[model samples]
Structures are given as C-alpha cells and as structure tokens.
Target chain A: MRLTSWGNLSLDDYQTFFYDFNPNLLAKIPKPVIAVGASRSYGDVGLNHLGSNLLTTNLNRFINLDGNLVTAQAGINFAELEKVLNLHKLSLPVRPGTSYLTLGGAVANDIHGKNHHLQGSFGCHIKSMRIWRSDSGVIEISTQREPDLFFATIGGIGLTGLIIDVTFEATEFLGNQIKVENLVFSNLSEFNQINQSSQNYETSVSWVNISGKKNGNGIYSRGNTVPEFAKKITKAPISYPKNLKLNFINSTSIKIFNNLYQNLQKSIKISLVPAGKYYFPLDGVNNWNQVYGAKGFYQYQSVVPEKNAYEVTEEMLNLMKEEKTYSFLTVLKSFGDKSSGGLLSFPMAGLTFAIDLQNQGEATLKLMNQFDQIIQRAGGRVYLAKDARMSREFFESSYPNYEKFNSLRDPYFSSDLSRRLLGF
Target chain B: MSKILVIGSTSGIANEAIKIWLEQGNHIHLYARNHDKLKMQVADLEIRFPGHKIDAFTFEANNLSKTLDQISLDNFDIALITVGELKYSDELVGQIQVSEKLINSNIQIPLAFAQTILEKYKTQGYGKLGIIGSVAGDRGRGKNYLYGASKAFWETYLEGARQEIWKNKNISLSLIKPGPTNTAMVQGRELGNLRLAKPEAVAKVIVNGMERGKSVIYAPKIFQLIMFIFKIMPIKIFNRLSF
Candidate 1:
C-alpha cells in the first residue's frame, strides 16, 4: 500500500498490516515496523518506508468510561471520542487542531492545542498505557510503574512501542458551543501582548500572514465553551475530487485567500461556534491538501523559548521575505509552563509557529533549512510530527534527551523519521 | 426498547450493526466463539452506551446446541446471524481439513443456528430474523467457489424459509447479501479495483432492510445489479473472465 503523512509528502509504497484485536498478531508482523494511527502526523514520523506499517484504525474501541475518566484503544480518534464524551457532557482537556488524530498519535506526538496554556499537552492527562514492544513484549506502564519507559513512550514517536490502549481524564464541559472572539494583531509584538491578555481564555491561537507582505500581522482568536447547551450538528465533509490534477494554491491565491480571511474576520468580534467547527475547521474539507497539488506541501512547526520567541519569529519572517516564499497557513501560539512527562515531548514554555509552505521542491527545502538554522540558534526545536526534513545533528542538539529516548526505543520498531535522524 | 440477539457479534459487520441498534435504544445479547474477545467487546459496548443492557455468551460450534438450549430466545425481538468463514485455495483436494472447516463454519454451523432461531421465532409468534449471506452466493466464482457454494446453500435455505413464513404476518426473515465489505473476512484478499463497502454502511442497510421487512437485500444496492448481470452471463464468457 502507498502511504503518506498528512502533509502528503514522502509518498512511498509500504507493506501494511492492519491491527486486529489481538496482541499475537504483532509477533507475526515482520519487524522494523511502526504502528500508525490515522497517519495524521505531517511528516514521516508515522511512515515506515523500509518496513511494515501497522494500521491501527481497526483497533478503535472504548474500553471503559467511569465518570470523567475514559479508557480506549489506541486507534480511537478524538472525533469518535468527542462524540462519546459529549453524551456525558464532557470535553477533552486538550485537543489538537484536528480531531482526526488517534489517541496513539496524540500521545506519540504529545500534541498541544488552544488550551495548552491551561491544560498542557495531551500526554499530561494520560494516566497509563498498554504498549506492545517487540523486545520487551506486551507490558503496562504508568507514572508509578516503569516510570522511565512510560515517560519515554509518551512522545517517543512510535519507536518505543506500539501503544495498545490509553486511559485519560476528560474534563466536564457545559455544552458543545464555544464563544469565540477574534482580534487582529499588527505584528509579533502586538500578537504577544494580545496573547498574554487572552490567557484567561481556554483556547487561543493566531493565523499569521507569512507572505511577508504584512510581516507578523494576523488574526488572533480566543474561545471558551459557552455555558448554554447547543444541539450537536454534523455536516458531511466535502471531499476534493481525486482525479483533479491541477494545483489551485499558489502565492497569488494564498495572498488573496489570507487577505480575504482577515477581512472577513475583521467584522466578527464574537460569535458562538460548534466545538468541532472551532477545533477542526479543515476537517470539514476532506483532502484539503489536494489543493496543494501532487507535489504536496511541508508544514514547518517550531517552538522557541519565550525570551527569543519574538526575535526568532521576526528573523523567520524576514528570511521568508528574502526568499520570496509564501505560506498558505501560518499559525502562531504559546505553550504553557506545564511540562509533559514525555522525554521527547515537543511542547515547552515558549511561542510556537507552524507554517504550511507549498512544495516548491528545492526552493522550499532551502528555505526550511534557513528557518531551521534560525530556530536552532534560538534554542528551539522543529516539531518532529510536522518535520519531513531535519538534520540528525540538529535533532540531537534540539532534544538533549534524545540519547535517553534512543536507548529506550524498541529495537525491532523503526520509522522513516527515526532512520533518518537516529540512523537505525 | 427491544431485545436484540446478535450471533457472531464480534464480526466487524455484526459489531457495527449492533452499535446502530444499541444507539436506537435496543438492548443487545451477544454470542461469539472467543470468550475473552466477547468479554472485551461487551465491555466496550457497555462503556460506549452506558445505561443500556448488554449480555454476552461464548460458544464453540460443537457446543452450540447446548449453548442455545441454555439461553431463552423468546424475549428477543430481532436476531441477526453473521457467522461465516472465508477460505481461498486452488488446491481443493489436498486441503481436506481446510475445506471441511470452511464448510462447517460457512454452511453447517450457520444453517443449524438459523434453523434453531427460525423454529424459536415461529413458536414466539412475532420476530424478525436477518442472516448475512454474500453476493458470491448468486453464482460461484473460481477464486472462492467453496465459500460461494456455502452461501448458495443459504440462498436456497432462506428462499424456502421465506416461503414458510410468508403466510405469518408477524414473522419476517431477511437474507442480507453484502458485496465485498471491508471486514476481517476480506481484509487480506486481492480486491483489485473493487471498492469494498464499509462494514458500518453495510450494517445500516442490513438493519434498515430487516426493519422494513425486505425478503432480500444487497447492501450498497449496486451488488444486486452486478449479481443479476453475472447470473445472466453465458457460461463461456463467464469462464473466460477471471476475478
């Protein structure tokens, strides 16, 4: 089967095995395999190009739900989990931009969301997990038991083992509606000020215009779950036609789209939106990446410490301007001080910027390398989940705990990312 | 709320169908071959649909008679039989054990279970029954004719049973003929360009058709026409074509 990350980059053929509800099946699958859930990661972190890719989507099933705590199989995506939680008037403490991400993916990536400032990354809420390792066999781990392995596995990028199931705490929510407020920031400085002011809000993020025409100018939005109950609405996603061969997204179109989006949001100060629409707007347009063309796109997400955040971001924007590169979607947000237990966790107390650059092939790669240099100098690390291209030296430097995580990795399990960065 | 009995409840299609029925406020009774798997499935269903009644029983084919005898079927308003096995082999004569297992799983066991359910439904005076057959049953193909032949037996058996219950307005039976569905049964098969229907979608159609009292249903609805075309094709042309 041909597999690619959510970025649609690094497409390659792989021998795939579906994870049926049996641990013994793991032993049968030829190793150096990686377990993939939804393959929502933007890079090759979920891709096992050299070996088998264990598709865990079929492993989806709820194990138990007691009050606010929920235990479920690794393959159960947040979209399904949210629906079940909504039934009990509960909401996930932390959720990524897209609900299509499976629990295993979330834990592996240690994903952060709009509520990161208050709730921290997804791994923070995880109570325990059952993982199947080729070297160690099936074992259960948590903070109280095998703490080192437990922490390493949290953001271990599926190299630690294949997560079987996870138990997590879900917080209570009043309703399915979010009262959202959009505010505009003229620059990175202004955006930081506004972000600080909106810290009380449960969710906060900004869509920056990285075309360099406006530098750091963007729309900053903050939202919180409204107290009043609203009926859950489900609209069938519109899928992009597979046969369409043309790329509709370009620098010209991206600029036009960004300007139009900003202008449209200028008038909308506050409104009530469904949680799904607020959290996963892109999900409403299935295969939205197809618009980027067959060449696909690269999502570069990096987090820098708070002190260097402004300077590093300004340098990145200037670099993009110098290179004449345009990003279709540029998201900027802040991470809270609450650190995750995952040794290789991406989120830290810093400001993070994620931009989707159209694959201009060599030009894009060169530009990304420049951004990587700026980030590395500022003591920042590119998110492995969204990185398709990053040097091994930079990876080791960025994640000081990399050696420890490497020591704990399941020898029989490997991924394109691990092979590229760790040389396994 | 109605009581629903689902045999082979752990199968992908049956599990999905049971979820739909449960969501519609139906209490479910599950029966599967694996005790541990059945327990896990029951726990999963219980967690997903809290406050709903869910009971499960595990039984092997040989002890199926004793298992059926132990559980009362009078309360179940609907019964869905989704048990079957699919084995592909070109060397039929040499693989006696494989052939026997396929026959026992796909034909004998399901037929016996269906007979027991039909008899109970007749005695209960009012009940709905759905048995999952396959599109392959319309005409045996070279790839999996043994499995196809077993389904053909179901087509004939259901046809006769439909006739028996035609006069009884309270009793109904539906033979669900699903095309290639993306389930564990067809997971590893080389489906070529054939698009497998989602088990959830197939289950929805099956449950809906059974509720509406349809005698026969081809899930995805496209299979009915495809099967008709195949059924009318000349033997020479059919022989030349390979799946």
Candidate 2:
C-alpha cells in the first residue's frame, strides 16, 4: 500500500471518475479530509483532509506543447513533465524538491527553487493560467486576462480557485547532470551571513546541527549550475538506505554518524554529479518515506525574512537542542518571492529552512510551535502545502491575502483540505 | 431561522441528521471533537442546502462540566443528543473499572445537560429535546448489559422528566428507541425477522417523533411489538429463550 493519502474519498471512486459531478458534492457527502500534495511538502497541508478529497494527479495532461511554449494541467506531476521536457531539451525555471506534483499544485504553492534569486518562484515562470473559478466559470488569467485570479492562483493554496492548466516559461539545459559544490559554515551567525551574501549568487544550501539550540549552526553546501565543461557524471553519492529509521539509532551511533556527516561536509571543495541526481537524491527509492517508519515524519519548513533570519535560525536550533529532538535533514535555503496564488505561502525574500525529523511526540510540536511563533512575528510564514498542523487564527494571520484567496475558492466544493483547514 | 444543534455530529448518524436539517431549510449548528472534520461537512451541507444557515461548536458530550461551561444552552432552538457509550473493552470489563469510565462517558454525564437545557427551553416557553436512545435500554440482557443498563436508565429518566414538566412547558422530550438496525456497532449479525434499520431510517423516526410531539417511539415500529410480546412473556419463559 502506498499509504499515500491522496485526499480523495475512494481510491476506487477517484480511480473511476476520471470525472464525476456531485450536484452538491462539496456541500453534501464530504469524506474524511487528508491533504494530498506532491508529498514534497513537510506536513499534512497536502494530506487528505477527509474521507473524500479532490485528486489532482490527473490534472497533469499536456494540453498544448508549441515549440518552447507548453500549457499543461495543474495536476500533472513534475517528474513526468520533466521526462517530456527532457526529451525536447527544455527545462522549467521553477523546480522544487522532486518532480511529483501537479502543475496546478506547483502554482498553488507558488513554489520557490534553487535559482529563486534569478528566476523567482514557480509563479513567475507562469506566463498565464486557466482557473475554474467557483463563483465564475473557467477563466484565463495572467498579468493581463484576469490579474486577480492569476496572482491569487500563483500562491493561493487552491483556495483561490482550481488551477486547470498553466503556461510556464522554460529554459534550456545542455545535459541532465547535477552541478554541485560544498562549503562548511562554522555557526548560526556565519550561516546567516553566507545566505545573505550569496543572494543573486548561486543556488546554495546548507545543513546545520538543529539538535543543538545552543550552538545550532554547523554545515553549509554552496552550489550552482556547473558550466557545461564542469558537468561530468561520476558516481552517485551513497544514498541512504530505505526501510531504515535512524531516528533513534542509539546515541552512540547518532553521535558517530553526526561526526562522520559533519566531517564529510566540512572537507568539501567542488564536484560534478548528475543533474537529476543533485535535484532529487531520494527519488531513487520508491517508498523512501518508509525510512521514517510507519508512524511517518514531520517536515518543519519555515521562512524568515532577511532581517530575522539569524534569530529564527538560532531559536529553532536552541529549541531542538534543548528538547534533544534530533532531525535527519535540516536544510537551509533562500526564497525570493513575496507571495504565491495560495492564500498562505512560506516565501518572503528570506532564508527558508526545512527540517525533516521523525515524528517523536510533543517535542516536535513544541519546537515547531516555538519556531512558528518566531517566524510569525518576523512577518514570515509556513508553506500550507507542507503543513499538517496549524491553528486557523495562526494561518489567517500568516497569510496577508487570506481574504482574497478565500473569495476565489469555490465555496461549494468540499475538499478535505477545506474541511480540515476550515475547522469543519 | 430554526436554530438546531446536533450534538455528536461528526459520525455517520450525525451527518445524516445534519443533512435532513439542511434539506428542510433549517438553521444548523454542528458540534464535533475535531473542528476540521466539521468544517468541510458544514461547507458540503451548505452546498447541499444552499440557503440553510449553519455553524459548528465543539463539545464532548461525556464531559458534562466542560459541556456546561462551553455550550450555550440557549444558542439552539432544539437540542439533539446522540451522546451514549456503546462500546466496552473486554479488559476494562474484566478489571471492573469500566463502570466509571463508561458511565461517565455515557450516562450521568449526558444526563447532566438535561436540567441545563430543559431550564433554558422552559424559560423560552417552547423547544424540543430530541434524544437518540435505544430499545436495548428497555431491558438488560447478558451480552451488552452495561450498555443496555445505561440506556435503560436514560429511557426511564426521560419518561420521568416528561411528566414533571408535562402541561406547562411546550418543552417536549422525545425518546427514540431505535431497535437493532445494522450499524458499525452491529457489524455482521443479521437480525432475522427483524430488519436491520439504517441510520438514516432511525434518524427519520427520531425526527418524526420530535415533530409529531410523540413522547416515545420505537423506530421501525415492529421492534416495539416484538419487545411487547417479549415483555409480556412469563419471566421463566423469557429467561429461557435466547434473544
């Protein structure tokens, strides 16, 4: 079983409907809500909201592919999109964790990627899109057609409207290779400085010791698209094993692995790898989530404005350290855009870090809440797509344009997301 | 705007009751544990019945103290209670500690709201207290005696409360005795000669009894006759036969 909560009523009903019209589907037979997303999200934002959910998987059809101009459905997964574009030597400027989300979902999240400084979010790459307005009918929107819906859809959390299909801008890549570099930062201050200085520089990311709130800053990875000459496929980095949860691998083993990981990251110069390999390391194992075990893991991703980046980073680390809650991957990156179509997004021209940890009870919730408060005050926010838990008040406060987003959403449709998020 | 409150509104029975209220163009206030579950339901229900006014409030029917503190007794015109404990763990039964947990979650806790709500209804001069009880409360049997006993107490309580207020308060209390209808509680066993009633069906009877001002009703009607025949049988013979 994929245990994939697609936020749909029946895997069977969803499977059959290629399409079905419920006279009052949203208002009537709402199923248990579990949000469904690209699974790239850290939390239940995309997990099913209830018994029945709207499936975006099929929204991936390529409606029009004219030369470099391609219009595709929002439900199309990125992986398949990449395969098609790869055949034609084309690339989307906005690429997130993995190619497993609908184009609509991408825009709904207003996803930011490695080259956000240069290109901005996935929304910026979107030239135009067609939305199924709840109040209105289907309308084409862009900077021109229907600006409100267009902007709202860019980061609107699917609340604004249904992203049927979007026209995305593309860039060309020579070979499918991951160009990378590595650097090590000493502490929290150094990491913050590195992130700010690197803006408009490279698609750089860093890993830190989130376990130690006291001295939380640890490792950094500065990377960029290697020049065609430097793009060489060598060997894949030793991928982590599947079906293994190192969440609590004896303190001794954790200490040992931590030491090795820190050391390995510390002594790094520059290396060339496969493009797909660098973009998606975990894509190798089909059911890699199983590594977190049956209980699953919570991915805590938040964005802090440029000014409060350091404090946010410091506080997050200190809380995790104090709680002694360990994480497998604590990654730090930068986001450029201010908003997306979804009512709530995690970007605001700041440093965004995603901490992946095995769900370990109150410790995680407390730490995440502590971090949430900090980010909220700093005028930062969490990505709804990657969120499983958040207060309605907090969510409303986080997104400045929440009211606008709500107006766009079809009040009649009952998505599990709408159910859970709305406190139904 | 008939403000209706449906307690225990997150389950299947609650959903059906909510739908009926919506279909009838009445105002509704849903109550549930997890707010998210109720959120979507309200939205969907609103869609189902476009003009119905609806809202949701949270309450744990078993926690009388909290329910009293949180729930506004006058916020609704009608109070519907589906608050009852139907399940008992073998371990708890064996340990004999279930008496408190089950009773609190089911009996005394819900009964606590009677005076609170009835007082409000009496003051207002007109209101209905529709409760979903069970025929199992008619008499205690061997298998689920604890559950049956709790309902029996509730049934008897309603019967007494009905007389105490009788002529003065347009406040009506209808006891809905829904006899064995196949539900998640009764998973597989077929009730031969006794058609298993659907929750929708049970909910309808409860609604009918409340609307018709009938003090008590056995859902499916046949169950009442069967129970009457059983009730009139000699004690020795009744004890000798299997249910």
Candidate 3:
C-alpha cells in the first residue's frame, strides 16, 4: 500500500498494517514498524517507506472519563474526543490548530497551538501513557514511573514505541464562542510588539504576508474562549478535486490572495466566532494540500530564540524572496518559557515562523537547506513534524537531547525521519 | 427514547449506528462475541453519552442459544442483526473448520437471534427488525460465494418474513444491503478505484431506512442501481467477467 503524511510530500509504498485494539496483533507485525495515527504530521515522520506502517486509526476507543481526566486509545482524534468532551462541558487543556490530530500524534509531535504561550505543548497535559515496545513488551510510563522513557515517548516522534493509550487532563470549557480580535502588523518587530502586549489573550497567532515588500506584514489575531454559547454550525469540508493536474498556487495567485485577504482585514476586526472556526480554519477544506498538485508541498516551520527572532526571521524572509519561492500560507507565533516535557519537543521560549512552499523539487530542497543554516546559526530548530528535508548534521545540532532520545528509541521502531537523521 | 437491541454491536457500522441512536436518546442493549471488547465499548459509550441506559452481553456462536435464553427480548422497540464474516480462499476445497465457522457465524447465529427476537416482537405486537445483508447477496461472484450465499439466505428469509408480518401493520422488517464500506472487514483490501463508503455515513442511511419502514435498503442508494444491473446480467456474460 502507498502511504504519505499530511504534507503529501513523500507518497511511497509501505507494508501497511491496521491496529485492531488487540495486543496480540502487535506482536505479529514485522520489525522496524512505526504506528501512525491520522497521519496528520506534515512530513515523513509518519512514513516508513517500504517498511511496515502500522495504521492505528481503528484503535480509536475511549476508555474512560472521570472528573476532569479522560483516558482514550492512541487513535482517537481530537475531533471525536472534543465531541464527547463538549457533551460533558469540558475541553482539552491544549487545543492544537486542527482537531483532526490523534492523541498519540499530538504527544509524539508534542504539538503546540495558538495557546502555547499559556498551556504549553500537548505533552504537558498528558498524565500517563501505555506503549507497546518490541524489546520489552507493553508497559505503562508516567512522570513518576520510568520518567525518562515517559518524556522520551512524548515528542519522541513515535520512535520510542507504539503508543497504546493516553490519559490526559481536560480544561474548563467556557463555551464554543471565541472573542477574536485581528490587528495588522507592518513588520517583524511590530508583530513582536503586538504579540508581547497580547499576553493576556489565551491564544495569539499571525498570518504573515511573506510575498509583500514589508516582511511579516499581515494580520495578527488574538482569541479567548467566551462564556456565550454560539449556535452550532456544521459545515461539510470540501475536498480538493483529485483529478486537477496543475498547481493553481503561484506567485501571481498568491499575491492576489494576499491582497484579497489584506483587504478583508484592512480595519481592526473584532468578531465572536466558533472555537472550531478560530482554531481549525484549514480543516474546513479536506485535502486542501492537493491544491499544490501532484508534486505536493513542503511545510518549513522553525522556532528561533527570542533575541535573534526578529533579525533571523527577516533574513529568512529575505532569502525566500531572493529564491523567488513565494509561500502561499505563512504563519508566525510566540512560545512562552515552558518545557514540553518531551526531549524532542519543538517548542521553546521563542518566535516560530511556518510557511508552505510548493514542492519545486530541487529548488525547494535547496532553499530549505539554506533556511536550516540561518536557523541553526540563530540557535533555532526546524519542527520535525513539518520537516521532510532537514540535514542529519542540522538535526543533531539543533536538538540537544537528540542523543538522549536516540538511546531510548525502541530498536524495532523506525521511521523515515529517524532512519534519515539517526541512521537506524 | 427507544430501546434498541444491537447484536454484533462492536462491528464498525453497528457501533457507529449505536452512537447515533444513543445521541438520539435511545437506550441500547449491545451483544458481541468478545467480552473484553464489548465491555470496553459499553464503558466508552457510557462515558460519552452520560445518563444513557446501556447494557451489554457477550456470547460465542455455539453458546448464543443459551445466552439468548437467559435474556428477555419483550421490550425492544428495534433490533439490528449485524453478524457476518468474510473469508477468502484460493484452494478449491477450503478448510472444513473455516466453512463451519462461516456457516455458524453468518447464518446459524444470526438466524437464531432473529427468530427469537421476531417471536418476541410478534407476541408484543410491534417492533422494527433490521438485518445487515450485503450487495454480494444479489448475485454471487466467484470471489466471495461463501459469504454471498449466507447473505443470499438472509435476502430470501427477510422477503418471506416481511410478507408473513404484513398483516401486523405495526411490525416492520428491513434487509439492509450496504456496498463496500470503510469497515474493518474491508479495510486493507485493494479495491482498484472502488470507493468504500464511510461507516458513519452508511449508519445514518441504515438508521433512517429502518425508521422509515423500508422493506429493503441499499445504503448509499447507488448500490441499488449497481445491484439491479448485476441481478439481471446474462449468465454467460456474467460468468465471462471477473470482479
């Protein structure tokens, strides 16, 4: 079977096995396998390329929910979990950008969202998790018991073992409404100023118009869950046409889109929107990546230290313009001083910039390699969940805990990213 | 608030339908083969739909009769039988144990449960019964004749049962034939451009059809036309083609 991650970058054939929520079935899967849930990671982190890829979507079963804590299988995505939690007037402590992410995926990636400045990454909220390791069989790990392996497994990129289930704490659910305020920032420094002043907001992120002359000029939005309940609105996601042969996103179209988007937010706009609309706008369109065409697209997300953030991001944006690689979607956010617990977690106290570039084959790869050099120099690291082409040297240098995580990785578990970087 | 009985409740489509029914405030009694899995599912549902009445029982094919005797079926407003299995073999003579298991699981167990429930429905004077048949039952191909034969039996049984219960006026029986769906039963198979329907989508159609008192339903509705073409194909041409 052919398998790929959300980025649609590397569609390679794999020996796919579906998890049936049976422990015995795990023993039968061939060695060097990785358990993938939702395949929401926008890179080869979930792909094994000709090796075994254990599809864990079928393991999606909620085990229990007591008080403010909920336990569920690894394959239960946030969308399903949120529905159940909403019924109980509860919500997840850290809500990622998209609700389609499975609990295991969120932990493996240690994903951060608009609220990272306050709640930290997803791993911070995990109480405990059970993993099935080929070397030692199934075992439970938590902060107290096997603390090293527990942190290793979080943001461990599914290389530690196949996560079986996780118990996580839920946050208070005020309502489904979000009071969103959108402000315009003219430059990276201005964006940083606004981001610093908006610390009171629970969630803050910026959509940067990288194609424009003023680098990082775009709308900066801040949101907080409101007490007022919003009327439930269910919109069916529109899927991108599979047969479309050409990529419609180019320099000209991107400019038009940026202009149109800018026009919509020319004035400071304040509106009450649904939490889903505010948090997961991209999820409204299924397979939106297909619009990049058969060649797919690459997402380059990097977090730079706060001191070097402005200068480094300016240089990176200038480099993208120099290379004539106009990113269709560019996002910027700030992280607080909070550890993600996971050794390999991406977030740190810094400013993070993410952009999507069409897979221009060698050109995109070369440009990303250059971006890595600047990020590495600024003591920044590319997000593994969204990286498909980071160098082994860069990975080893960027993540100080790489060796520690490598020591704890399950010998029988491997992924395209691990095999490429760790040389397993 | 309706009392719904779902046999083989852990199956993908059945489980999804159970969720929908639970959301609609229906009290569900679930029965499955694996005790642990059944218990886990029931627990999951109990937490998801707090305050909803949910009861579960586990029984193997050989012990279904004994299990059925222990439980009462007098109050169920709806009963859905979603018990079936698919096993493929290339050999001319498949293993006897496999054949026996298929027959017992797909035919005997479901038939026994249906008969018991139908009797209770008849005595109680009103009920809706739904059995998940398959489009394969319309016309068996060389690929899945064993499974097809079992569902074909259901098509015949339900047709007769619908006529037999026609005078009851309040009683209804529906045979649901769903096309290839994205269930565990057909998850990893290579279908060559064939689109498998989502279990949730199929469940919605099944529950709607059962509520509307449809005697026969082809979920996705497209399956009705496809099955019609297969059901009337010339024998020679059909034999010459392979699916």
CA-lDDT, candidates in order: 0.86, 0.64, 0.86
Q: What is the per-residue lDDT of model 3 for residues A1-424, given as tens digits with 9 covering 90 to 100?
A: 6677888878766777666566666566667788888888899999886457887877788898888889999988898888889889898788777889898898999988899999899898899999988777889999998999999999999999889999999998889989999999898888888988999899998998877777769999998888988778887878888668678988999988888888787664999988887888779888888899888889999999899789999998889878877876889999998886789999999999999989888888998999999999999999999988898999999998999899999888899899998888
Work out the TM-score per prediction.
Answer: 0.95, 0.56, 0.94
Best model number under DockQ:
1
Clashing pairs in 3: none
Ignoring the other chain, what TM-score does chain B have in each prediction?
Answer: 0.95, 0.85, 0.94
Q: Against the true two-chain complex, what DockQ does each candidate achieve?
A: 0.42, 0.01, 0.39
Candidate that beats the other on DockQ, 1 or 3, i.e. the better one: 1
Per TM-score, what order, best first?
1, 3, 2
lDDT of 1 by residue, B37-74 (tens): 78889888877787888989888888677867755535
The sequence of per-residue lDDT tens digits that candidate 2 reaches over residues B151-207 is 777677888888888886567897777886534344222222444566677777777
For each model, chain A TM-score?
Answer: 0.98, 0.83, 0.98
Candidate 2, which segments miss by more than 4 Å at Cα?
A: A1-39, A48-51, A211-214, A227-253, A337-343, A414-417, A420-424, B1-243
State the lDDT at A196 in candidate 3.
81
Please, what are the lDDT tens digits per residue for candidate 1 over residues A363-408? 8999999988999999999999999999999999999998888899
Predicted candidate 3 versus true structure: per-residue lDDT over B1-243, tens digit per residue? 899999999998999999999999998989999888798898888888889989888887776767687545357799999988877655325588888788888899999989988888888999999999999888878987888888889888988888788899888999999998767785444344456687889999999999998999899888999989988899999998867
